[model samples]
Every structure is written in structure tokens, then in C-alpha cells.
Target: MAEKPTLRWGILATGMISSWFVADLSLDRQDAQANHVIQAIGSSSLEKGKAFVAEHLPGKSPTVYGSYEELYADPEVDIIYIGTPHSFHKQNCLDAIRHGKNVLCEKAFALTAPEACEVLDAAREKGVFIMEAMWTRFFPIVRALQQKLHEEKAIGAVHRAFCDFSFDMKIPSLGPASRLKNPALGAGTLLDIGIYSLTWTILGLEPPLGPAPARAAPEKTPKVVAAQSLDDGVDVATTIVLLYEDGRQGIATAHATVKSQRDFARIEGSEGTVIVEGDAAAVPSSFIVKKLDGEEKRYDFPRPGRGFYWEADAVALDIAAGRKENAIMPWAETLRVMEIMDETRRQGGARFPVDKD
Candidate 1:
């Protein structure tokens, strides 16, 4: 067996998401593909970064950089896992790429499709690997579901998919300039949680066919129709419908202010419908397959960590093989998803300030 090449990761921000991801690496669990290391922590202050490292990357000491520039300049870092705010992704990835670090950026790769393109184009030109960290795409259950629905034809011609990712994040109390409601910060339910709904839709309707850069083959962007309820200029509730050329459709709903029942997603097909149950859409635990002929089966995937490690391993796998992108979540696919969100925001009239500028 070829020795797995370790990918040294430089975490871009010290946030809850970043903590979850870093802690996943240190968890001694079933997954032994321990091929990635947290080399550095970057934050607005060295003290904050050091605190984060001590809290999450426990038992191991890594260099803490006061600024992202310091982390980017470090030769020990091989790749960057960007857990910064949505508005910061483009600039962060650009900086990381300029320093020749591969990137696995947080979802909603940018505030808009154009920004995502800007980052992707730079990565392509620099010959460095980069991908949107849509970690759900790398989850064990999702992987098994993809093979079953697409390859095995278990569902037999999927017609539509429906997913909802909502939480009582209390947007009303978060203040206008707070990260949840601030337009300049790329704040909205669509980008925050709707992205996951839309992700599941794409997974069901348009499973990517391996990593394809630009100039490979162009397909029409998904037709998006959406509606949003605004809360002080931010989307508090949003529903988006994604339509494929083949008439397949998906409805993804998200809400930010009010509490809603945590729902399981369903994909309807000719033969059966697959339902995924999750506390949050991003972390699904099990799925039930119910066939039209009255047969049913349940597939459960208990996560070992916060379920971020799989994608981290995937990043290492791609970089080790000298690949520029991940087949599971390709660059073109990220742009397409971002474009879909842009369209949804446009149609829903939920424009961020960044969009106006």
C-alpha cells in the first residue's frame, strides 16, 4: 500500500466550525486515515488563536499566527481550511492560493457566484488544489446514498427532492450588523442554512461526474425560483425550487428567526423514496428507503466526530495524488451551486449589500 501523504492544515479562523473540524482530527475513532495535521491556527490576535489551539487541537502544540498573513507565509502549512465568515471566503482563498496552499473553503464559497469564480479561476491558474468544504458530500451516509440512488438505480429514476434546514438562530436579536443579519457580511438564511438544502437538492438531481475544470463541458445552470421573507433586509424565511432540464425538481426551505421542526429530507423516485433524518441538515444520522411495492429498509450512519473529518481526509487524498480538485465536490460544481444561490437570492429579492456594491 502506498504511504498516505499527510496534508498539514492551517485553520483560517477560530470559530465553532473551526473548533469542530480541528477536534475531529484529534478524536481517536474508527477512521484511521489520519493523514492530515493541524499545523497552525490563524486569528485576529495571537492570544485568541493560541486559546483556540489549546481548546481544540489539544495534546499537540502548533504555531499560532496573529494574522492570516503569518499563517499563509508559514512553509509548514500545506493547505488551508477556511472557517471564516461567508464574506471573507474569497479574499481568504485568494491569499492562501497566492501563498501556494491548497484550500478547502467553507460553503457558500463566496458571497456570490462571481466571487466563487474569482477564487476558482485563481486556483486553476495557480495549479493548486481548492474545493468548497461542502462536508456533507463526503459523509458516509451521503456517499452510500449516492451510489445507491445513482449507480445501483435503487430509487429508479428520481423525480424530485425536498430538504429543509432551519434553526432558531434568533436573527431578530442578533442586531442588524451582527454576522447573521449583516448584508455586508453576506448574512442570510439562504447562505447560512439554505445552502445545505440546496446542496442536498443538487446531490439528488445532479450528482457530479468527477472533477471537471472549465472548458470541459458546460451545462445550463439549474433553474431557480424562490421566495423569501425579509427581516430587516435579511432573509428570515426562504424557499427555493431548483429545476433541472429533465423536469426534475427540488424544493429547499430555510428559516433563521423562528424555531421549526427538524425535518428529514426526501427524494421521490419511480421505485422508492429515500428519506434522510437529521437533527440538522448538515449532519444526517440515518435514511429510510421505502419502495412503492411496500418493501422498506433503513440505513443508519452514526457519526464518529462532528462528521467533518471525512472531507478533510478527502482533501488530503486529492492533494496527495496531485489532483487540483475533489471529484465529490468539484470546482465547477461549487460555482454552479453558488450561481443557483445567486439566482435564488435575486428572485427572492433578498440582496445583500455586497450584491449592491
Candidate 2:
């Protein structure tokens, strides 16, 4: 048997996601085959970084840095995991790449496709690994669904797909004052939570065509129908129609106000329909599929922790194997999502000050 390669990881940003990731990594220590280790954590303040290391990481005593630059420069760190806010992803990733470190940046990779492209180009030139932390794509259930869709033909030629994710922020007003309401931070339901729904659409929809276009092949192009925004600069709500040349359509919606009982994706075809309950980006405990023959099937997947450990494991394996990115969350897919998001913001009139100039 091949021995697992040990990978030393540097964590950038000490936010909620970073905390969760640290806890998950620590738990991975129990597995003898797991090859990842958190070597250091960098926060805006030394106090915060030290506190995080104390509280979550305990006696491991990983180095703590007051700034990301210090973390990137740490020779012991093999890769950098970015957990900064959406607005800072591009710059954070570029810095890590410049320092010759591999990166696994959190979702909403960047506010714009152009920014995402820049990061990807930098990673390519440096010959280092870089991937969007779209953890859901690495989930067991999601992988199972992808296989089922292809093998069973449960949803034939997916004619339409609908996905929605909504949560009540309970904000009193819509203004630039609140980060949730601020456009400058790239804050919005779409970027924060809607990206999950978008993942479902992207997964169900196959890649666009190029030289070869089969008769029943997935569409070569997609066009957005409309995008709506609330009074705030952020997109409190948005509905996007992804059109395929093959006459297939994927509909996605995201809203900040009001809660959704079930945030899932429904893919319909001529033969049957599959209902993915829970956020596809964040897999739930179970899912169900309904067939045209009046039959219903259910699938359940339960894992230890918040199910984020899988992505961490994937990152460790990839870095140890000297890979540039996760095949599931490729740089191209990240760019495509960012492009769609940029267009959605433009059509909805939710422009950030940075974008204005």
C-alpha cells in the first residue's frame, strides 16, 4: 500500500468558516491515513490568532500570524486555505500564489469572473494548486447523485432544473451600513447563500459544447433572462434562467427575506424527476427521487462533524499528490459561476462602488 503524504496547511483569515475548518482538521488527527495538518493560522490581529489556536487547536501549538503575509511566508506551511470574505478572495489567493503556496479558497471565489481568471492565471504560472472550496461537490451524497443521474437515467435530458435558497436576515433596513446589506463587501443573499443553489444548477447542467455537439448533447451556451434586486445595494433576491441551446433550462432563485422550509434542487426531465433536499452546497441528511412509474426513492448520508471534513481530506490528498486543483471544483467552473454572478448583479442594478469605476 502507498503511504499517505503529509501536508502542512496554513489558514488565512480567522472567521466562522476558519474556526469550523480548524475543528474539522483537528478531528482528522484521529485517522492514521489522513495526511493533512494545520501548521499555522493567520488573523488580522495576533491576539485573535493566538486565541483561536488556543481554543480550537489546543496544544498543537501551530504558529500564529498577525497578518496573512507572515502565514504565506512560513516555510513549514505547504498550502494556504483562504476563509476571507468574498470581496477579499481574489487578492488573498493572489498573495498566496505569489508566495509559491497552493490554495483552497472558500466559495464565491471572487466577486467577478475577471478576478477569478486573474487568480487562476497566477496559479498556472506559479505551477501551484488552487481550488475553490466548494465542499459540497466533494460530499458522498452529491457524488452518488451525479452517478445516479448518469447511470439510472432517472432524469432524462434534464429539461428544467429549479433551485432556491432563502433566509431571513431580520435586518431592519436595506443600506450600506450593514455588511449583509452592503454591496461593497460583496454581501448579498446570492453570493453568501445563493451560490449554493447555483451549484445545483451547474452540477445538473453539463458543460457547454465546443467542436463536437451531439444531438442530445448538453447545450453549448446559456443566457440569463432577468435579475431583480431589493432596495439595498445587495441582491436581496434574484431569479436567473440558464438557457441551453438544446432547449433545456435551469432556474435558480435566492432571497434573504423569509425562510425556506426546504432548500433543495428539483431536476425534471421527460422520464422522471429528482429532488435534492437541503442545500446542495451544504448537503443535508437525506434526499429523494420520484420516478415516472409512480415510484419514490430516498437516499440518506450521515457523516461525523459538519460534513466539511471530506473537503479538507480532498485538499490534503490533492496537495500530497502534487495536483493543481480538485477535478470536481475546477478553475473553469469557478470562473463560469463568477461570470453568471457578475451578470446577475449588473442586471439587478446592485453595483458596488469598487465596480463603478
In terms of lDDT, the best-performing candidate is 1
lDDT values for all models: 0.85, 0.78
What TM-score against the true fold does each predicted structure earn? 0.95, 0.91
As a whole number from 0 to 100, the lDDT of residue 347 in candidate 1 is 83
Model 2 lDDT-worst window of ten? 207-216
Residue-level error in angstroms, candidate 2, position 301: 0.7
Tens digit of lDDT per residue, candidate 1, span 119-220? Answer: 989999999999998998889898888888888878899999999898888776776667787888888899999999988877776554655454335357
Q: Against the true structure, whose TM-score is highest?
A: 1
* Candidate 2 Cα outliers beyond 4 Å, as residue runs: 28-33, 173-178, 207-219, 279-281
Error of 1 at 114 (Å): 0.8
Worst 10 residues of 1 by lDDT: 210-219
Error of 1 at 145 (Å): 0.8
lDDT of candidate 2 at residue 92, scale 0 to 100: 96
Candidate 2 vs. true structure, TM-score: 0.91
lDDT of 2 by residue, 1-357 (tens): 888777788999888889888787677445444566889999999999998888888878889999999999999999899998888899999999999999999988988888899999999999999989988877788777777775666767668888777778765565556557666777887788788877778677663222212323433448877586776456778888888777878888877786665637888877788887763336655668788988898998877777667787777777777778766676667887888877877777777666744
Model 2 residue 10 lDDT?
A: 95
* Clash pairs detected, candidate 2: none
